[model samples]
Each structure stands twice: as structure tokens, then as C-alpha cells.
Target: MHPGIIFFLVILGSVLFHIFTPWYWTDIASNWGGMDDTITLTFWIGGGVFIAVCLFMIYCVLKFSYKKDRKVEYKPEDKKLEKILTWATTIGVAALLAPGLIIWNQYVSVPKNALEIDVMAWQWGWQYRLPGEDGKLGTTQVININDDNPFGINLDDPYGQDDVLIQSDLINLETNQPVKILLRSVDVLHNWYVPQFRAKMDAVPGIVTYYWFEPNKIGEYEVLCAEYCGIGHYAMRGGVEVQSSIDYKKWLSEQETFKELIAKQQKIEFGNKKIVKNNNFLLNKEIYKEE
Candidate 1:
């Protein structure tokens, strides 16, 4: 019946609505990532403080509120009170931030042996490249795209010799593997989003960004584009099937041998090209303008 109670009820209802809202992207808040525990701890501490303050205000309203026929009294703000509040707030902040900072440091410093994988996003599809037998990913660009060079890897670079290019349905397997994702986009911006893993990063054109995660559980997870780029943004979805170590090994071997066959065939075809077509070079100045 009171105005204050009515106002409180309205605010409570709004908060409940937000909590129970069905709209959600990834389970980043509820699920734990590399530094998720620290985040959750900070959230709980903040929630506790909010609840304590609200309860104290409620007590003041009910206990010291206006009463009829009572003499009004007012007191000046206390310096000791302000000092106590300041120290309490400082300690609370330190308690909340210290563990979070420590965990963040660990997250940033990944193990040296952790496998690195490259993810290139384009107009509508995603391309994944692995550092084949070697532990290095070669640089790539879109200008060199062709059937022979699917991932546009720098062939002149010696480090690219053992690099693995997986552009199609090659990552499906049966085991869990730790992988670090280095993201790049050829066109507009996109997001490498995997909800179950709680991992995501922006795929910006011209610049490279990345995130790493080891899927402990095995299942088929859908990767969604968190940022809308074009009309096909809603349809920008892919599948990642995490498999066991044995199945993953088997899959990797098959991919390697298959790629080897293709590479050999391409080399042979290029070498067999005769000089018969070399004399037909036309001197068309207008048609051959440089782009």
C-alpha cells in the first residue's frame, strides 16, 4: 500500500525479468572458462555487497522514518564514518581484484607446448589450418587463393613445409584435444564463437586475434558468428566435433596422406606443361592494363 514498497516491488520485478530472460548468447557467465572462477567470485562478492546495502536502507526506512508529532533532529556527516567506509571499500576491492588479476596472468601465459591452430574466416565460411607435423603455422593471405593453394600459405617460407591446411570437413573426430585458435578475417568482421566451450574472439580483417581452449568434454558444438556482418550473418554457423586422441590421430593421418597425393598430382601437372603455348603471347596493351 505504501509508495516506497510499490517502488521496490517494481524494481524487483524488473531485475527478476532480466535474470529469467530467455535471450542469451553463450553461457559465458554461468560456465567457467580459463579465468571464469575468478569472475564468478567477484560477481558473488558484488551481489553480497548490494544485498547488504539494500537491507540496511530498508532497515533505516522502517526504523527511523517520519513519525507524527515527533521533534526532528539532524546530525552532521561524520569524518570517522567516511574514513571507515573508505577503508572498508578499499579492502573489499582488493579482495575482489587480487585473485582475478592472478588468474588473468596465468591465462595469458599459455604453456609453450600447447598446439597452435589458425582459423581464417571469410564471406560465409571458416577455414582451419593446423601446423602439420611441424609446430609452426605459416603466414597466409587471400590474394594467393587457388585450388593448388587452398589456404594461400606462403610456399616460399621454409616453415610452411609441414604446415597442414584443413579447409573442408576435416576436424570431425572422436577425442579431446587442446588447441589454440588464431583468428583472421579476409573480408568483414566475424566472431569465432563456440558456446559450449565458452570461447570467442573477434575475427577482424587485416589484423589477427586469438583464443585457446582444451575441450574436456566430447560432443558436437555449433560455432555461431557473434557479430552480424551481412545478410548471411544469421546463417553463419559451423560444427565442431571434438573427438578422442585415437580418432583424432586417425583423422589427421588420413588428411595428411590425402593432401600428399593431391600435392604430388599438382606438381606433376605443372611440370608436364609444354612450351607450345608460350609463343602465343599476344601484345594487347589495352586489355592487359595493370590493376
Candidate 2:
């Protein structure tokens, strides 16, 4: 019936449950395993504090319970205790914040050899652009966007002509190669996240964001939008397949270039116009004969 005993039991149960829980992180396939280390460090710091505070409360409850004949000591404050608490709190906070800062620095620093890829997110789907043999992504703007040119890649920019466009959600990358992913959003705000890679960044409507990672293992990773956007937000899913260099190259080679896509669209429109002109001519000739 004692409150102290119940507190002890609660702490014990929590520790046991955490130790025996089957839920753990997925296998990391990228070079950002340091992220896992940072998380573990945070868990230890937070969990340790929880356990210590609860145990201390239980001790006070048991030791100070209903002393019928004892007089309570009225000590205002302890200067030494205050100093110790202040320094301890400061150190704990710094420990938690320092690793995250270090990781963020590395996350934003792209290597010179890192291959650049553009990821565009919309309300219900994802699109990608890869630089062609030139290894440079073309300039893009929101004003140039249309049904035919979804990426809004500049038509007048010669550099954009050979940019490879992937209309589908699937993307392929070479294993053990570093890549810098540029994130953009057309309709609403979204986040490009893959758990196995342990890297994610937001795609804002007006500005571009980016993160870098190297897939050291060959596997397929599922991509999900971490931010809530609209009704189809739950269905907005995609994938990334890391493969050998040869297979990656083969897949890239099959993708359509920006210029090729524009030309194809023009041809289809031209054919439709010709058909309409022929139909009008036939109708006019028939009316003239009747008259």
C-alpha cells in the first residue's frame, strides 16, 4: 500500500519493458550510421535522468513519511547544491546539442565528387531529374511549369536540353557513390524521407532544400512524405533502388532527355492540328457541293 513501493515498481517495469522491446532501428544502408549513435546517446541521457528522478522521489517518500515526533528542518537553500545542479544541467544540455550540430555540418557539406540529383514533390506523387553526361542540372523556375513541362526546366537554357527526366516515382542509384539530392515542391510543402538512409529534408514551395548520403549497400528503400500535405498524403510513396554501377548506368541511359520530351510533345500536337485541318476542309467541300 506504500506509495514508495509503487514508484519503485513503475521504474522497474519501464526499464524491463525497454530492455525486452523488440522494436529497434532498421538496418542502416547509408554512411550516416553516426545518426544512430547520436540517437542512442540521447536515449541514455534522457532515460538515465528519468530513472534517477523517479528513484530520488521514491527515497524521499519513504524517508520522510509521517514522523509523528520529529521536527522538520527548515533550510532555505544550499549554495553548493545550487552550483552543482547548475553545472550538471549545463553539461547535459551541451552533450545533447553538440553531436547534432556536428552531424548537421556534415549533412550539408557536399563533396566535390558528389553526384547531384533533383527531387520534385507534389501533392500526390514524386518526380526526379538527373544530369545527363554533362553532370550539371539545368536552371528551373516555377513560372515555366506546365502539364507538358512538369519540372519547369528552362527551355531556352542549353544546359537543360540533355537533363534526364524521370516521370515515375522510382529512382536508381549506384552503390557506394555519394549523392547530393536537391528537394523542390511544386504544389505544397513536403518532406523526402527514407528511414534506412537516415537522411531527410523538407521541400518548401518557393525554396530548394538538400541533403547528402552515400548508399553503401545494394537494396531497395521506401520513400515516404514525412510532412502532412493533403488528402492523398498517405498514398504519396516512392522508392529508391541502389544497384551496381552497370545497372544504374543502363537505367539512366533509358530515361528520356528534356529536349526529347519537348520534341515528342510537339510532334503529337502537330498531328492533332493536321487532323483538325483535314476535317474542316472536308466539311467545307461538302457544303460547297450542296450549295
Candidate 3:
């Protein structure tokens, strides 16, 4: 059999495998269905190009292979073919990129009413923080993370007093609510990713990165770290539960707050329950100096 026949068989098998493959995207539970559409568009464009190129190669192989019956014809510089190939390649690339750019614009542009939630990642686990009734999260510092103060929330900041803290692996989100997740890291690089939500972002040390998604379905989803940070990277996983507004609020009310954690920390560290220098991180501010 000619090599062209073998190549044709391989292409056919690949196409069949892709079509019958059970591995594909999980069911989307977030408002990022547009992301799925954009990805599908990419797959279509790529597949078309792959098949077209393979067919062209096969045609060339079978038609131009050295044959004693046919004299060798040396032909180069087909301007018409060159123009067609150039235009085709340009159009394919543009089609592939345009949708992603459009989707990316929407991705970074957080909705005006989207709730701001903080996600802190470490080498091995996940933590979450949400504003209390004040609707504002307190400022945080890397220097403040300790046994009792795991979130590194600035205790001096009033807004963070009511910030709800979830030091557990499971979290609950309100259905149909758009949320802008603020990603942070204290140790090394990590990522906060939930496949069903169709959004993920990196957690870089000394800085914050973010992505947003709205959970439209009331279901549980597994969250995974998409980046490798260390040996524990594979086990750095969590979960999210999308629930009704009432149920979500109930869950939120049960979580501990930063101020509460500080108070508990005070009791544990100081057996007699005492207070100490409170402005370790905030004393340098001019406003505090004047006060």
C-alpha cells in the first residue's frame, strides 16, 4: 500500500477517535457558556484546517510520487496557489483569534453588580473571604498570616472586621449571582479553577490575579488547582456549592469572621487573654501617627 493510503487511514482514525471520545468539557454550571462556544469554534476551525492540509498532502503524495511511466515535471512558484494558501492561513488564524479576544474582553470586564470575593491559595489548600454586611473586604498584608490569622487580614482595618472567612475546602455560592473572585497567594504560585465554571486564574506571590463567573446552576462543583506549585499541587483541590439565595445566606452566616478569629487567637495565645501592640503593620501611616 502507498504511504498516502496509510496517511489517509491515520487521518480517518484520528477523526473517528475525536468524535467518539468520551473526554470533553464538563457540563457548564456558570454563565460562561460563551466560553464554551468560543472553544468549540476554535476546535471547528482547527479540525477543518487539519483535515484540509492532510488531504492536500495525500493528494500531493499520490499524484507527484516518482513513477517510471510519467516524466518528472519540475514546477515551482505557483503564484495563484501561493496567494490562496496565504489568504487561507490568514483567515484561519483570524477566525481562531477573534472569538477569544471578544470573549477575553468580556472576561476581564467584571459586571457592575458582581460580588467581590477573595480566594487565597497556598502550596496545598484553598481559603475564601467574603464581605459581611458592610459589603467591603478589609485590606490584607502578607506579614500578618499566622496560626490564628490565616487570612493575613489587617486587623486594624474596620471594614475587614466582618469579613467572613472560610478555612475549609468546601464553599457555597449563590445561584445566578455574578462573582468576581480576587485571587491571592502567600507562599508560591497556585491557581483557582473550577471546570464547570469555565474560569480560572493564577495566584502569584506578592500580587493578586482574578477572574469572574456567575453560577447559574444550583449544584456542587469540584475545584482544582490548574498550576503546579509543589508536591502537594495534585491534592490542592476544593469544592463549591451553588445554592439558593436563602441557603447561601444561611451558609455564610455560619462561617467565622476575621475579628472573631483574632479574638479567639487572643484567648489561645494569651492564656490570661491579654492584648498587645496592635499596630505592627499600620503604625507607619501618617494618619495613625497624627492620631
Candidate 4:
């Protein structure tokens, strides 16, 4: 079989496989359908280049194959060809990059009314903080962190008092509402990724990163750590549930505030100390009676 013929067959098979493939992008559940469009445009441009190069190779294989009577030309370079190639490459790269830049601009520009949520990541878990009725997230720092204040929210900041803390793996959002997620990391690097949202960002230590998305559908979406931080990285999973505004509010209402959590911890420690004191008093009385 001729090499040119084999290459032609390869191209045909590639196209046929692509058209008949069962794979496709996941359903767009957020307002970022533009992201999908941008990706598809990139695929078309890259696939076209691939097919063109393959066809050109096949053409050269058939047309320029060594022949007993033919002599090869020794042309060094073509100025016109070089200019055409340069412009083609520039246009191709621009076409691929322009949409991404536009989308990125919109991604970083949070709407004024978008709800703010803080996502804090650790080695094997996720924690969340949502602004209370104040509608403003308070200041936080790594220095203020402890087992009680896992989110590192400043205890001195009055604004942090009412901040709802969710230590569980599930986060709930209102459907059709824009949400700006502020990402943070307490221990190591991690990524908050939800495939349906088409948005993800890094959670760097001592820094806050963010992205926004509006869930257009009501469903449960799986969240995974996209970065390889450690051996337990694979188990660092979470979830997001998009629900109606009423349900979202109800869920939020049930979450504990930062102030409440601190008070609860204090009460537990006090009770433990009281029990120990009573036990010591009883032991001293028994010793005195024995003497």
C-alpha cells in the first residue's frame, strides 16, 4: 500500500470518528455558555490546522515522491510564503486568544449585587463562610485561626460575628443568582472546582482568589480539588446544591454564626473544668477523713 494512500485513509478515519463519537461537553448549568463557545471555536481552529497539515503531507508524499527522471529543486526560501505563514500564524493565535481574554475580563468583573461567599480549603476538607444580614464579609487572617475559628475570621471584627460558618462538605446556592466566591487556603494549595459551573480558581496560602458564576439550573454539583496538593488530594471533595431562594435562606438560617461557635466551645471547656474541680474536692475530703 502507498504511504500517501494510507495517510488519506487516516484522515478519513479521523473525521469519521470525530463525527460519530459519543463524547461532548457537559451541560452548561451556569451563565457561562460563552466559555463553551470559546472552547468549541478553539477546537475547530486546531482541528482544521491538523487536517490541513495531514492533507499537505499526503500531497507531498504523492506529488514529490522520489522519481528516476525527476530532479529536486534547491530553492532555499520563499519570501512570499514566509509572509503568508507569519500572518496566518498570527491570525490563528489571535482567534484562539481573543475570546478567552474577553471572557476573562467578564469573569473578574463581579456584578455589584453578586452574593459573596468565602471558600476555605485545607488538606482533606472544605469550609465555607457566608455574609449574614449585613451583606458584607468581614476581615480574616491566618494568625486568628484555631480549631474553634477554622475559617480564620477575626474575632475582634464585629462584622465577623454574624458570619455564618458551614464546616460541612455541602454548600448551597440560590439558583439564577450571581455568586462571587472568595477562595482561601489555610494549610496548603488547593482548587475549588465544580464542573457544571465551568468555573474554578486556586486557593493559595495567605492570599484570596475569586471567581463568579450564576447557577441557571437547580441540581447537585460535585466539587473536587483540581490541584494535586498531597496524597489525600483525591479525597478532598465537596458539593454544591442549587436551590430556590427560599430554601437557600432557610439553609443559611440554620447554619451557626461565628460568635455562636466560639461561645459553644467556651461552654464546653468550662464544663470540663467544673467536673475536674468537683472530682478534686471529693478526693481531698476522703483523704482528710482517712487521716
Candidate 5:
């Protein structure tokens, strides 16, 4: 069989395999935000160029292979040809990079009115903090973990008084919910990943990191901790249920009730219960702080 034909067949098979596979990430998300579209464009263009180059090389090798006693023809390297290839490569790279940088900039620059939520990761579970009605989530630490306080918020600071805290509850917010996620790690690094949202970010210990996304679709999506942490790495998973705004509020009310039950079950003091409840609630500057 001709090498050229074999090469083409091999590439064709690989492409077909890639097409038939139902892996989640490769398939487009339910929501194609600006960043998602930019990625698609960049990948298609770059991949086309890469495959063309490979196939061209393969064809050349097969066409120009040596034969017994075959006379070899020599052609001097053309400066003009070299210059053209150099410029082509340079321009191609720039074309590929420009959109990526633009989308990245948009991702980092959070909208002025995005609702902020703080996410904390530990050995085997995930915790969340939402600004109380006041719309401010105060800074937190880990030493406060107890029956009364799961997220050690510095209550003396007054800045943390109304922040709402949650551990392992599915929050269902209304459609087009604008959420800004603040990620932190208590012990080891972890990654918060949601395939349907096309969003993922690392939860590094000792440093706070985050990402934001709007859940435009209404459905339940699986959340996975992408970073390998320990023995329970595979089991470190969660779920996000996107719902209408009204439905989300209803869910929030239920969570509040559930939290109260949890406190009673642990025989936690009312004062300490207030502290933990405030850790996940929202608080605006006017009610909590001036800044």
C-alpha cells in the first residue's frame, strides 16, 4: 500500500474516532458564551493549519522517497520562499493568539454588578458563602470549624456578621443568574469544574482564586473537583441545580430551615448558630460596613 494512502487513512480513522466519542468536554456546552465561541474558532483554524502541514509533509516524503540508483535533483533554498514561510508562520500564530487574549481579558474583568460567592475547599468536601441580604461576604479562616462554626469567620471584624455560609447544598438560582465565585483551599489544592458551564478554576491553599459565570441553562449539572487531592479525590464531587430566580429563593428558604435543623442536631448555642448562619448570608455595606 502507498505510504500516502496509509497516512491519509490513519488520519481519517483518528478523526472519525474523535468524532464518534461522546466525551463531555469535547462536546460543546449547553451555553456557548463569547469565550466558548472564541475557543471553537481558534481550535478549528489552528487544527486545520496543523493537519494541512502534517499531510503536506507526509505527501512530500512519500513522493520524493529514494530509489536504487535514482538520480537526485537538488534545488537551492529560495530566500523569498523562506521569507514567505516565516511570515506565514508568524501571522498564523498572531491570528491564533489575538482572540484568545481578548476573551481571557473579558473573563478576568468581572462585571460591576456580579453577585459574589465564596467557595472553600478542604480534604473531602466543599463549602460556600454567599453575601447575606447585605451583599457582602467577609473574609474567612479555617480554625473556626466546630459544631457551632463550620466556616471560621472573624465576627469581631463586623464585616462578616451577615455573610451566609453553606456546606453541600444544591443552590438553584433563577435563569441568567450572575454569579462570581471566589475560590479558596483549606488544606490542599482542588479544582472546581462544571462541564455544562465551560468553567474551571483551581482552589489553591493559602491563596484565594476565583472565576465567574452565568448559568443560562436550567438543569442539574455535575460538579467535579478536577485537582487530585487525596484518597477521596475520586469521590470529591458535587452538583449545581440551575433554576428560575423564584425557585432559587424558595430553595434558599428551605436551606435556611435545614441549617437550623443541623444546629439543633448538634446542640449548638443560639449565639454560635447566628455566627455560622451569618457566614453564608449576604450583607451590604450600609448594614454591615461602609466600605
Candidate 6:
């Protein structure tokens, strides 16, 4: 009797705690409500199974308690009981997995008209690339990466020259615009996650993975790396700001293009060499005069 009461109390406490818990899903700002639905379905199935099992245990404790006058019956196996248990277990497992499988099927299907944005991840930072007015992104290679070309932009590629290079961690998006995010990693593996968007994908090396979502809300959201890449993994954070089309265009215009970035780097390098040559000439004239 006492054990049955404890099980009842545990079930009651669990339900109450869940109902009043402070932490729950964040407000979704994208078009992935199916993801949330799948999660809610999982919770319901799991909670139902937990309550049913506990109730059975409570019944057994109260009705089958040991007594001095009671005699035990030894029936080792019952085919009927075994079949019922097997079917119940199979149905419960299937219920938990089917919703997830359905949602995952739609998660990878990118739309035809979705805009393109490239996200590059490193140990502790994020970089982005967006297509210019040409509506196309330039190809990149790992071998082309250097101090002057951090994004590994191929200088010879005509399409890459006009690509907008965003070095900042905070990226801007247009609300109601369907955009596909292309993920890449310069170093170790990382996962880009934005809770509000309900979308994230692994940034794998030497390959690209992608997912798409249309931002329906106009606001700023926190971006987090869901994978542990290294010691600085905790600090691998970024942000996204969804705005109106006019504001997004203004922000995009303010960003530098790959062509402009290359020109600036070249000017700096040339200026440094010119300064060194002038200093050498001055030193030579001074020695010649002294002689």
C-alpha cells in the first residue's frame, strides 16, 4: 500500500512540475512549426507510456503484496501475454519515431526560388557570403585561402568578384524571404543553430550542407554553435537580424564586395613596398655622401 501511494505521488508531481516549468520552447520566428509539432507529439507519447507503466506498477504493489496466508502460483510463460506485450512495445516505439521521420523529410527539400547565402564556420567565428546583383555566388576552394583571401575567393572567377563578403558575425535577412543557407567549415566540424528559426545543419569540411527557412518575424535572434569543435566552442556565437526589404537592401549595399576587398589589399601591399624602397634609397645616398 505504501509503495503504491509513492508511485501515485511521483506521477502527480511530474505532471504538475511539467505544467509549471519556466523553461519551454522559444518563440518560433520561421516556418518550421512542423518541427515543434513533432516534438510535442514525442512528449505526449513518452509521458503517456510513463504514466501507464507507473499505474501498472502501483496496481501490482497494492493487489499482490506478500501475505502469510497467500500461496503463489508458478506460471512461467503465457503466449497470449507475451504477444500483447510485444505488440504494445512495437506500437509505442513506432509512434515516437514516425513524426520525426516525416519532419526530417521536408527539412532537406530546398525550394526553387529561395535566395542563397553561404555561411563559413571556424573555431570561434562565422563569416558570410551573399550574391551581388548578379544573383549568383562565386566558387571557392580551400587551397586558395590565405591572409589576403580568407574566404578563399578565386580571383580568376568572374562571378566571384561581385559577391558580397560579410566579415561580421551579425548577418541581416529580409523578412518573408525564403533563403537557403549553405554551410561550410574552414577547420573542425560545427553546427549552426538559431532556436527561433528551428533550423540548423552541420558545417562539414571539404563539403557543403544546406537548409532553408523563411523568416516571418522581424527581429534579432541569437545564433549558437550546437557542436563542440574545440576549447573555444562555447564562445562560437553569432546573430541574425531580420528586417524589411528596404532595410536589408541598405545593409547589403553597405557591405564590401570581393573585388573591392582585393583592390584594398593590393593598394596596401604596394604602398608598403614603395615605402621600403624609398628608405633604401635614402640610406644609400647618405653612405655615398659620407664616402
- TM-scores of the candidates are 0.73, 0.97, 0.90, 0.97, 0.80, 0.96
Q: Best candidate per TM-score, number?
A: 2
Compare the candidates by lDDT and give the number of the best one: 2
User: What tens-digit string does per-residue lDDT give for candidate 6 at 1-291?
Assistant: 499999999999999888899998899999999999988888888999899999999999989999999999999999999999999999989998888888888888888888999999998999999999899999999999887887898889898999999997899999999999999999999999999999999999999999999999999999999998999999999999999999999999999999999999999999999999999999999999999
Off by over 4 Å in 2: none
The per-residue C-alpha lDDT of model 5 at residue 42 equals 79
Q: Which segments of candidate 4 are over 4 A away from where they belong?
A: none
What is candidate 3's lDDT per residue for 143-172, written digit by digit as tens? Answer: 998877888889789999999999987889
Cα distance off (Å), candidate 4, residue 153: 1.0
Minimal lDDT window, size 10, model 6: 102-111
Which segments of candidate 1 are over 4 A away from where they belong?
3-36, 70-76, 141-150, 173-176, 256-291
User: Across residues 262-285, which tens digit of lDDT does each residue of candidate 1 receive?
Assistant: 579788887666332343343344
Question: Which structure is stronger by TM-score: 1 or 4?
Answer: 4
lDDT over C-alpha atoms for residue 165 of model 2: 95
lDDT of 2 by residue, 1-291 (tens): 899989889989988988898998899999999999999999999889889999999989989998889789999999999999999999999999999999999999998989999999999899999999888999999999899998999888888999999998899999999999999999899999999999999999999999999999998999999999999999999999999999999988999999999999999999999999999999999999999
Off by over 4 Å in 5: 24-32, 73-77, 142-148, 256-291
Query: What Cα-based lDDT does every candidate model obtain?
Result: 0.70, 0.94, 0.89, 0.92, 0.73, 0.93
Please give the lDDT score at residue 220 for candidate 1: 74
Candidate 3: worst 10 consecutive residues by lDDT?
272-281
Going through the candidates in the order shown, the clash numbers are 5, 0, 0, 0, 21, 0
TM-score of 6: 0.96
Say what the RMSD of model 3 is: 8.7
